[model samples]
Each structure stands twice: as C-alpha cells, then as structure tokens.
Target: MGQAGATFPQSLWDPSFLFLTSGTSEGGSREGLWGHVDQLNRTLAQHTEDIAHLRDDLLDCRAQLAEQLEKNLLFPQISTSLLSVALMYMEAQRKPDPEKAIAGGTGD
Candidate 1:
C-alpha cells in the first residue's frame, strides 16, 4: 500500500482525499490540474508582452507629437517676426517727412 492509498480509505465518506486515491488510475485528474496551470501561465506571459509593446508605442507617439508641436510653435514666431519687419518697413517708406511724422503734424 502506497502513501496515497494508505491515507485515503476505500469508503466515499472522505470526498476530499478519496479523489486523490480513487480516480481513472491513469492520473487524469493530476494532468488536468497541470493543463490548467500551463494555460494560466501562457495567458500571463501574453498579457505581459502586450503591455510592453503598448508602452513602447505610447512613448514613441509622445516623442513624435512633441517634435511636431515644437516645429508648429517655432513657425508662428518666425512668421510674426517677418510680418512685424514688413510692417515697419512699409511705415518707414510711407513717411515722406520724417520730422513732421514724428511730431504728428501734416507739414502745413
């Protein structure tokens, strides 16, 4: 009598330990438990891989967006400076009499 057979009585009164000794005789129940464990481990590994890939993609998107924002922001400042210079040049050219223009007089 092995330890498994000795620990469990031949009666069905001990349902817990009875399954351990009385089964398909081919260890089918034990194999089922191991199969479940393997499936759970595979699921965990797949989820971990998916999360890592998503994190890397998010970081890459952030870097690209930041670069685009920097370029967009810098473009407006350059455009504003160019417009200001053009306006200043136009105002300087329109002023026929500089002294009168500064004094706010029509030169009458």
Candidate 2:
C-alpha cells in the first residue's frame, strides 16, 4: 500500500478560478455562496457564471485530492511527505480605486 506518486489535475491551479476581493470570501465559507451569487447577476453578470464554474472546479478538485490520497496511502509520516497541497489566490492585478485612494489617504 505504498503508491506515493499520485497526481492532482491542473484545474486546481487555474488562474481564472481566482479573483481579488476587498473583503475575505468567508461568506462563501459560511454556506452562503449560492445565496449571494445571484446578487452579482445584475451588475457583474459575467462573474455569476465565473463564480459558479469556479465552485464546480473546487468541488472537483477536492474529490480528486481525496481519491489521490487514497491511492498514496502508506505509513502516517511517509504519507504526509508524499503529498503537500497549497491553496492560494492568484492576485491577478492590482487595480486600486484611484478615487477611494485619494480621498482616504490621510485617515487611519
């Protein structure tokens, strides 16, 4: 039971699935992603689909990780060294709001 060469798909690291938000996406973590997803349908209509697609990919990635972990099973310490995963935001571009920056520059 020492198959330690398991692999995860590239979709897990796809840059398109990431975005930069002023606030943490903890709302999504709180079982409210779909609830608030529709709110973007009117203004950022495209993001609605993007968000949904990203959610699907994330779920798929989790499933794949589980499957891979099963295949890579071994002694506890060995298995831990066999697989290391890192989840991170892409931080695509730093498009700051000039008006907000200029207006709020002085305050703490």
Candidate 3:
C-alpha cells in the first residue's frame, strides 16, 4: 500500500493525510512515522527531477514547431515568385525577335 510495494498504508507517507493506525502504535512511538516521512521525501525529490526533464522536452518541441511554422509561412511567396519567372520565360519564347521579323517582312 506504500511506496508501490511496502506493507504500510499509503496515507502515512503524507503527513497531511496521516492518521495513527492501531497497528502503528501500541504505546505511541514516533520512530515509524519518521521513517515514512523520509521515504516520502525521497519520492518527492525524484518527482521534481522528472518534471524538469519533461520541461526540457516540451521546450525543444516548441522551438521545432516555431521553425516549421516560419517555413510554412514563407512557402507560398517562394512558389509565386518561381511561377512568375517561368511564365515570363514562356512568353519570351513565344515572341519572334524584332530584327528577324522586320527583315522577313516585306516593306509594308
């Protein structure tokens, strides 16, 4: 019931929830209570470390998302510029050179 496998009630680990169970006190001793408090302290310390690791992971994800969003915003403008260049090239190819066209034409 305590610390994932211990035989004591889980409530003893948290002083706020602690109640003196009949099993814990035949003559009212405090040693057992102190041991439970120590275990609980260790458990809480480990949890703080875990939370810090999770915070680092979340921050990394946020940075990656911002980079992707910037690329997404820029893609449309790049595509539009490329398309304009391609259309201009095609129009140029369709037109004959001014000198060639004039020479080939009769004096009209």
**Clash count of each predicted structure:** 0, 0, 0
- Per-residue lDDT of model 2, residues 7-108, tens digit only: 322463543223211134731242254446566656587777789999999999999999888766655656555443211122224456677789985222
In the range 38-83, model 3's lDDT, one tens digit per residue, is 8999999999999999999999999999999999988988999999
**Predicted structure 1: lDDT:** 0.78
State the lDDT of candidate 1 residue by residue for 1-108, as single tens digits.
556556544565766544653456643476675677699999999999999999999999999999999999999999999999998898776747878867998643
Mark the regions of model 2 whose C-alpha exceeds 4 Å error after superposition: 1-43, 74-108
* TM-score against truth, every candidate: 0.58, 0.29, 0.54
Specify the poorest-scoring 10-residue window by lDDT in model 3.
15-24
Candidate 2: C-alpha lDDT = 0.55
Task: Pull out the clashing pairs in model 2.
Answer: none
Measured with C-alpha atoms, the lDDT of residue 100 in candidate 3 is 71
lDDT of 1 at 24: 61
The better-scoring model by lDDT among 1 and 2 is: 1
